[model samples]
Structure formats: structure tokens, C-alpha cells
Target: MDDKSLVLPGAIFALFSIAMIWPPDEFVSAGATFEHLFYRWIGDFSLNIVEYQLRKILVNRVCVACLPALFSLYIILNVPPTALSTFVATAGLASMIMGLAYAFYTISTNFSQTRQVKELALYGGDVHRLMTEITQEYLEFANFAVSFAHSSREVVGSHWLIHITRFDFTIVNLTDVVFEVVRSATVDLNIERPNDQLQFLIIEAKIPHKNIKSFRFRVRTDQFRDLQDRVAAPIGMARNVILHQSLNERFVKAFVSCIDKNPRAVYSRLGELEPCFGCSSEIPNVKIEKRCTSIIEGARECRQCFCRPMWCVGCLGRIFAAKQEQERPDIWLDGQATCPTCRAEFCMLDVAFVVAEESQLDGNF
Candidate 1:
């Protein structure tokens, strides 16, 4: 549906049209008469065909040898065994050679876009599945904890309720036993979980005996802010939670490292920083000059994680576009965006461009 999708098909149609309307006499009388005038035009036209075929072969290497062989056979069958046949055969052979050469180049290009689509589907599915599982697990855990809290109140002679809050998943409690349970859950969820599904639960609870009436505990995730929006309860109650932690450190790291390692991190103690986490050559402070202005100019970050570099607008746009295409087959909502690093939901409009200001440049220097 996009302009890029139409490119190859449109080119094929134009080539087919040209070939259909091509006069047979033009081929036969190519060098027979008006050698000076027709010769250059014929040569140019033949070169154009060769170039076009070569380009096509670059896109699909499978067609390289096959197309040339088929065309060679056609030429051999059509042309009589005569002096003129030699010239036509030579032209056909030349086209075939060019096709073969370009075919070798196809390996480097993304000739099969289907591979990218498949990868996107798998990546999106895996993230979604992980998020669903984590949420379910958290819900179950919260229910158990709440029940334990109520039962403990009867034994302790003090009323205690877990009041879960935002960000850190902090849990407030009157008893040391409950505090330990909550702390263990937070650590396990944040640090011990799979690198790809790293997340923390935000919980709040009341300390019945103390002046400090409430306490909070947070299980940290890679994109805590993003998860906060997706997983939080409607009434800010822990039991009424909905966990949706789609983005994780591993996914973001893979995506960022897919193209290149962060140059800054490569030399620094950071080793290899994730570009999806807002580390890249394009960041103005990095002092690295990139040739692609679109990438450099379009850099943006999640507002929730202000200092951390998130993604170039172009890259994020493609990701958002791909997700939209995958989810809503009929309609695309361009404005919607979710940070893979912090799991924050935001509109495309909220993405701020990285502009190199005079003061900032001076500060960097």
C-alpha cells in the first residue's frame, strides 16, 4: 500500500509495456541501415534493457540464470541459423551475463522483505505472550498476598491492608513477615526474571502500628513507566492490577545492536549500550558525525526516561508502522507509539526531535 511496495510492480509493468510495443524491425535493422543515427539509439535502448534486467536480478537472484537461459532459448528458436542470428545471439548472451553478475549482488540487498515481516511477527508475538504471562502471575501472587494479609490481621490483633502504589511497586506493611515476602517478590520480579521479560511490581500497603502509615514497594522492569501505564489498576489498587510489560531490556538491546554497537560504549566501561535505550552515534553529545541526517535529526526519547536516549524518529516510526500494520490490517493509527525501553505509551507527536542548539554544542565542547 505504501509507495515503496508499488516500486517493483510499477517498474515491471512499465518494462512489459515497452517490450510489447517494441517494433520487431528495430531489432532486425539495428545495424543494417543508418548506422550513425540508429546505432546510438539502438545501443542506448539495448543498454537500458540490460540495466533493467540486471536491476531485477539484483532483487531476485533466483531469476538471474533462469531468465537468461529462457531468453537465450527463445532467441535461438526464433532466429534462423544465419549471419544475422549471430548478432542477436550475442546481444542475448550479453544480457544474460549482466543478469548473472547482478545476481551475485542480490545477496547483500534485502531482496526478500518477507523475512523482515516474519521477524516482526515473531518478535511482537513473543513480547505480547511474555507480558500476558507476567501479568497473570502477578495477579495470582497479589491475591495470595492479600489473603495472607487479612488472615494475619486476625492473629496479630491489628488491621493491615497492602496499598500498592506507582513506580517502585513499594509495599507498606505492619509486619516484618509481610515486608520480607514483598521484598522477595520485588527482587525476583525485577532482577531474577528472564532478561527479556524483566519487570517489577508496584505495590502499596499500610503500616497499622506506626506514624508512617503507608509504605510502597516496586519491582523494577526495563521500562517501568511504560509498564506502569499498561499494568496499573483502574482505581490504583494492587488487587485490581493489569500487568502488560511488552518491552524489555533484551528486546531493546537486540534491536539496538542489530545495526551497530554503540560507539561510545564500545570504548567506555559501559561496553555495549543499547541504542533503543537512547545510546547512539546520532546523539549530539556523543560528538560522532553520521551521514544520515534523517536518523540524526529524528532522534527522540521517552519523556518518562528523560535522560536516556530511546530511538531515532525514523526507526521508531517504522516500528510503530509495522505494529499498526500487524495489529490493524485495515486501518493504521500513525500517532500511537510505545517505548520498547520503558514500555511507555505515547503519541508520535510527543516524540521530540534532537536538534543541535548553539548552547548545547558549546556545552558539549
Candidate 2:
């Protein structure tokens, strides 16, 4: 695949904007210059002077150079079946005559225009939105691969000690306009032990497959911070994009639709809730936590405690014994419920008392 590039559209937009404002043929043809120029030059002096800035060297500088640069770009973007023919012919015409003349001025003064031509030579110079997109992609790739080994992390196997790696980025093939391939990179992932300086390493970068024409890339960290940052993050995002699983407008609407109805699940979306299905049950259509919101966060107890159903009979029996103990002047802890994780005993009756007390506050207020 081609590497990403951003030359074509920028060149086209910039050139075309210049062309539409230029003076006509009679004014541009050397001898018939200025005061005898086309009617359009009369109103916009700034626009007129801009067209003639390089005219001393090339009389039809803006017209001959910019128009074809633009029209070639148009053919590149418009991409009609016969558009390639237009671009090849127009680019050839633009290059031979005034191309060098305009390019010399562009390079000597504001050189961005000259670089665009170089990018065209690499990426086929057709106006395309893809140029910007591909450039952004290469930048993102560089942000990861540039620092492949040395970010910071705890080397888990070595007694949970912290360590940082050192690395550097190098570009290999800026020549390939289509794909900005970094041919070599060096990374050092270990801390220097006294005089035992850590050795730097060159990663054999393996881009899976690419198709790029022109791209601008920036150097970024090659060292990784964590396992997910190194491995899972990139693959997961790519997989989601490939699967068409973006959380866009349609997904948002569906999520809102689910939230409004109040389903049995705390969160309407799958995978959002932190749950233990081993502790959950389907008790007909009974909803849990109708009265107390606190139940959602910590109260692992289910429908029985909420509704005081048959299963809660075991708890009620324990509470009854404790109540009897209170009447007989004997100290006793309230109904005990065992926590499954820690096997710790909790006073279920005390929890019920707190819930009842909180509910009473609402009435008093």
C-alpha cells in the first residue's frame, strides 16, 4: 500500500484561488501588459500585483504556472474516468514552459509551493482529500513506533522494580513520497548499571500493508509505557474500525432508548456494568432496589432483602432471635449474613435498620 501524503489538495486549493483572480490573456502576454491588461485587473489592485509579482521573469507567471497546477489538481480530485488524461497532459504542459520559471520564484521566496511539486512527483500529484488523511495516519504511526522500546515500566519478573528505557527515532526513506518509511530506529530499554551503559537497538519496523502517496511525519516516543500501550491499543482500535463498531449518532440514540425504559440491568449497555452473575437471579419480573439507591453500590443482597420475600425468611428468623435476646436483657449481634468473598459476618438486621431510618428522613423533611 502507498504511504500517506498531503501535497495534492493543498497545491490545488492554493493555486486555483490564485488563478480565478488573475488577468486574462491580453494582459498576461508580455507586450500587452498592465494598463492594457484585462478588465478584471482594474478593481483589485492587491490581486493584480500578486499576479505580477514574478512577471518580470515570466510574463504569464500566474496564468501559465498556477492554472495547470490547479487544473491538474482538479483532475486529481474530480477523478472522472478521463480525468487522468487531463492531469497528465496539463502537468506536462505546466512543467516544461513556465513551470521552472514559477517554481524558481516559489523556491527562492516562499518554498512550500516547491515542496508540493516534489510531493507530486512522489504521490502522483492528483488533488485528493486522502492526502491529509494519510498524512495524519503516518503521524499517528510515528508517535508509537518512534519510541518503540524505552518508555517506563516496572519489570514485573525482577522483584517489581521500576526501570526506564532510552531510545531514538531515525527516518530511513523520506525519498519514497507515497510511503514515509522509517528504515531504521534505535531504542534502549534498560537503565545503566554503574559503568554498564545500556546498549541501543534498531527495530526492524514491519508495517503490515500500506498505500500512501505523500505524507508529513513527526518523530515521537519509541519506548512503550505499558503492555496495553505497546500491543492491545493499536490492534483494538483497528479491529473496531474494521468491524464498523463506532459509537456514533445511531449508537447514542439506541443507548438513550435503552436507558429510558429502566431495564433489569443497572446500565443498559452490555459490558458497562461490573457484575457477578453468580450472585444474580431471575425472580419473575421483580425489580431490585426500587426504594434504596444504596443497594446498587455495596449491598450485594438481592430481591429477598429488598422485598422481604421467602428467602429473607432465614434473615427474619435470625432477627427474631436477636430481638428476643434484647427483651431478655442479653447482648446479641443482629441477623448475620455471610459475605461470599471474605466469609465475613455482617448484621443484616442493622443494615435494614439503617435503610428504614434513611427512608423515614424523607417523610420528616
Candidate 3:
């Protein structure tokens, strides 16, 4: 092939290398990009240490071999047997030889070591079974959940089972969690205000080997409360894990506090209360009544919502959150959002938690 034709292939190879090494969020969301590219040689599963290591080694060797070969091919094709071309060709050839020798040495030394001997022996038993079972709960771009027979927990990243455990047959237990550290820093430093919306909940616990292991979960900024009603196994084992100082939990608490401070309304009859329009399961217990002093022109100010109690506290909190500037969560508490039913502008102070008073019917009737 001509030297000009090599430009496209070289660019493609560079991108492929980047994706393999430090994959972008997009590539990870695509699912098994690295494995799919080298499926023939690397195989599909990297569940265990042996498979993972072998795939790594194979990919490294291929890259090492291909890089020098491309360099040599370019020089050979472009330059016609000149002294410079000969020297370049020789250098490329020698480079490939050195790379091959290094690959051979690495492979030979790795195979001789018995570090993974125990792991290899236990792969077919409980190790493989745990990974296989956890794999079913794996969701790309979503929270990684590894559910065990006794407990279910959310992992930091997608490859936690393969990377962290390395198929050691260790059952991850966070039952004795002493404390959870919540981390929240501005994702974009250029922004003046520190965005509390972007946060991570970290839980540190001792794994099988008594080694301190930390599992981090990315907090969902959009949702005030974590959705526990998933199709996967119940993760109630770590239910209280995010309750301590989590930004999401803090948002919910702040919203509820605001609702409590607002003017409370009581219904004479319990029959007037209806199910929340957002989530049909819960009864609407909150009414939007303009209690804020802010009076701005247009639909920017807090206005009374003539609509009935059509939203529960949880649903109203979520709606309030959705209207605020996601990038600037600092102004979320003071932001105004339109009511879902009447489109009347309302702020956090306008939402009131309603209590229904039941009236007893006299027997004399």
C-alpha cells in the first residue's frame, strides 16, 4: 500500500490504542469495546485472572509487533533502497526483534510464576459462579450492583468483579461498615459555585483478606431519592449506606424541611386525597400554595397553584429539583418551578405537606 494510504490506518490505530488504555465514557457505555475488537485472539470473558492477564499480554504483543511493522512498511514503500531507507528498515526490524524478545521473556516469566495457581484451581467453583451471577445484574452506564446470597451492594465501576476480586472466591461483605465518606466537589472548576449535585458516596469495608476495600457509588443528581424498585435483586443490605451525608439524601432532606416550614393544609375528608400523578403508588399529601414573598414579572415569581393535591411530597421534591439549574445546584432551594397540572409558578416555600382528618359517622344518622 502507498504511504498516503497509511495515514487513515495510523489514525485509526492511535484512537484504538487510546480506547483500549483509558477508555472514554462513551466507549464504556458501548459495552466490551476492547474485548469485541480482539475477540478472536482474546476471547469474550475476562472473568478470572488467567483470562484477564492472557488477554492483556496478547493485546500488548500485537500492538508492539504492529507498531514497528507499520514503521518499516512505510519506510520500505516510500524510499527505494537508499542508504537512509536501508538504515530505517534495519532499525525498524531490530525494534520488532527486541519487542518480540521482550514479549517472549515476559510470557515465559509470567507462566513460570505460581501466583495465580490457587486462583486458577478455584475458578470453576464458587469464583466463577459469583461472577456469572453478578454479571446478570450488570447494567452499562448505570450503577454496578453485585448481589450475593446474603447481601447486595453497588460497586464503583463496571469491572469491579474482574479487577478488584480477580476471581479469588471472596464474598464481599459490608455488614460491619463503620462509616461512609461522602465526596462532593465541583466537576467543573471553572464554575464559580461548587456544584453539590455531582457527588459520590464511598463505603470502605474489609473484604475476605482483611484488606480495607472501598466501594464508591455515583450519586444521581437528577433524582432526589434513589430508586430502589429495580428489576434486580433487593439491595436493602446497603440501604442505609447512602443516607449518611449523601448529596442526594441531603437534597431530599432539604426539600422535606422546606415543605415542613411552609403553610400546612388539612383535608376534612381522606377521600379528597388522590394518588400522585408522577408516581401512582403514593397518595398526594402536598399542596402548592404561594407562601414566598418574591414577586417577579412574568412566570419567574412564586405564584399560587390552584391545582389540588395531585403530587406527593416525594414527587413534588423531584419536580422542584428538575426545574433548577442542574449545573448550579446552589440556587436549587430558591428556584421556582411550574405546577404540573395548572402550570402555576411555585417555589419550595409554596409546597405544603397535607394531613387528612377523618370524620366519624354517628349511628343516629
Candidate 4:
């Protein structure tokens, strides 16, 4: 038998046994004691019920529930001794009626809005809306960048496309003279639980080409805020950086060394080839001289200002460090950094390392 079934009968039998087994003289005193205890239990139960009803009324603001509760309280306070039992029973019945009525009202309201509830469940409600808004904003930024890149024919060398995803961005360099080079890189904005804040992940890097690698960095709120401010403002001068061959070589060496030490950090194994804007090398080459890395690692580049002289992570890091030294040499502070070529503010952490080919990393070997 279920516990409830056994427990219910057991309780009843115990109460009956207690009543039947008492001695005659002691029975009278026992009856008085039992009556007192029963009244006390009833009072406690009634108080708890009243407390629950009041809390329900406050939380739900159900006018129907409030009226019955208030009437019950009034009857309890004013009803004469002769009619106390009847009034108490009436109050309890009112409370029950009100509870049922409130439940019915809630059920009917939910049924009426079934379509809306279903839609919200399917589409993720607020989360979906947030994603849509972010996508639209990024699209507008990309269009503006593309337009600017086209207008400044001399400074900009390639057409770029920025693909917006839910949590990351894929930037593809679309300008290739001979054939379309699938040279692309990904910057992951790691939006954690609650999705309010974000971190950066470099999923792919193509410029100043080195092996594909991943690097993580922390993002500051002010730096994020600066990026947002730029998008909101009128499109201004597109920043372009042209890196010399000597500097490019130095950066490539640093990148290769880092990759050698941390082989697992290189996430992509794509064997794609693209002429480095800085060193004129087909990236992901065994030779560091031929590999080129993109200028802005984590930040999306403006298509109009995306030009040659791309630098690897090491070069960019040096430049950033130098700028910091020049600005505030004594006090160390990690704040917003801008592209040397374009003067556009970006989160350094979001910059990714690039590999020439992505398919090779698919475990074919």
C-alpha cells in the first residue's frame, strides 16, 4: 500500500485506541486535556490559513480573493459566541470558494493567451529580440565600412565581409585578383551565462599568416563602450596601417615561435593560400617569411580601410605596448587600444590568429 493510505488509517486507529483505553477517573481529565490541545491546533491551523490567504492576496492582487478574506476576518471579529462555530465554518467555506474562483480566473487568462505563450516559447522571447538587435547593429556597421572602403580606393586594398553570428564574428577578405581566396578569420565574443558581459576568442587568423591558433583575452567595459560609441557616431576617416617587410618578418617569427611552443593553441588546419599584404607570402606556409597576419586581431575591420601592411599578433602587441608606454609609462593600466592604421578602437582580446586553410584541421590525417 502507498504510504499515504497506510498513514491515514494508522492515524485514525491510534486516535480511536487512545480514546477507548482510558481509565474512567482519568478519562474525564484526559478528555479535558484532549479538548484543549485540539482547540490549540485548530487555532494554529486557522492562523496559518489566514496568513497564507493574506500573502496570496498581496502577491496576486486578486480582488475576488481579497473580498472573501476580508469578510471572513470581519465575521470572526464580530460574530457572537452562540454562532461562533457556524460563522467560523462559513468563513472557511468562503475562503475555499474564493480560492477556486481565483484558480479558474488564472486558468481562463492563460487559455486566452495560449498563442502568445506558444510563440514566446518557440522564439526565445527576450533573448531572440536581443540577438536580432545586435545583428542589425553589426550589419549597419559593416555596410558603413564597405561604403567607406570603396570611396577610399588608394588606402583600402581588399573588399571584406563581416559575418555576424549569435556569439562570434567571421571576417572574410573578399578581394583577390586571381581567384577568391577563402582567407577568413573568426573572433568569438564569448557571451557567458546571463549574457550581459563577454570575453574574446581568436578562432582564426589569416594575416601575417601563421598557423591557426586560439588566444583568449579579457574585455573591459569601457573598451566595449568605446566600440559602441564609434558605431553610433558618423563614419569618419578610415584608419589604414602599412607594415614594412622588416617589421612583418619580426612579427611572423614571434607568431611561429608561440605556435611551436603551444601547438594545440593553433585551432585551424586549413591549407588555404593568400598573398600577404605585408610580406607578399601565401599564409600557412612552413616558412615564416611567407605567412601574413591581419592587422586588427579581434575587432571587425572596416572594408573601406582594410589595407596592406597587416601585422601579426606580436607586432600588434608591441605597437600597443609602445603606445601605452608613450601615453602612461609609469602607471600600468589596461584600457582601450586603437588600430595604428585606422585609429579605430578595438578590444585587443578579440583579435584572433589566422591559418590559411580551415578544412585541414578536420582530422583528415
Q: lDDT values of the candidates?
A: 0.36, 0.31, 0.54, 0.35
lDDT of 3 by residue, 29-103 (tens): 676344446667665443443444455555555455556566677667765676655675787788787777765
Q: Highest TM-score: which candidate?
A: 3
**Poorly placed runs, candidate 3 (over 4 Å):** 1-16, 23-33, 36-132, 139-190, 194-253, 263-296, 300-319, 326-334, 338-350, 354-365
Model 4 per-residue lDDT tens digits across residues 1-365: 22233345446644643443322345545653222333432243223322222233222333333334544444446544445435544775677577667657645674233322232233344633533343344334223231111111101112432332212222323221111112222233333322222222111223223221222222222222222232332222112311122322333355445434321213233344443332332232222221223554443442222323355444454455455444343321232356666765543332344444554333322
Candidate 3, RMSD to the unseen true structure: 10.5
Model 1 gets an lDDT of 0.36
Candidates sorted on lDDT, descending: 3, 1, 4, 2
lDDT of model 4, residue 107: 58
Give the per-residue lDDT of model 1 (tens digit) for 1-365. Answer: 23243346446645643432332355335532222223332243223322222232233333323344454454466545555445545665777777666545544453233222232233335633433343343443222232121111111112222232111122222242222113213223334333324334554444345434354445443333432323322214344444543333333344334223222211121223354423232222221122222221233433343334445533554455555434342233333445565656544334433333433322312
What's the number of clashes in each of the models? 26, 21, 0, 27
Please identify which of the two predictions, 3 or 4, would achieve the higher lDDT against the true structure: 3
Kindly indicate the candidate among 2 and 4 with the higher lDDT. Answer: 4
Whole-structure CA lDDT of model 3: 0.54
Model 2 weakest lDDT span, ten residues long:
155-164
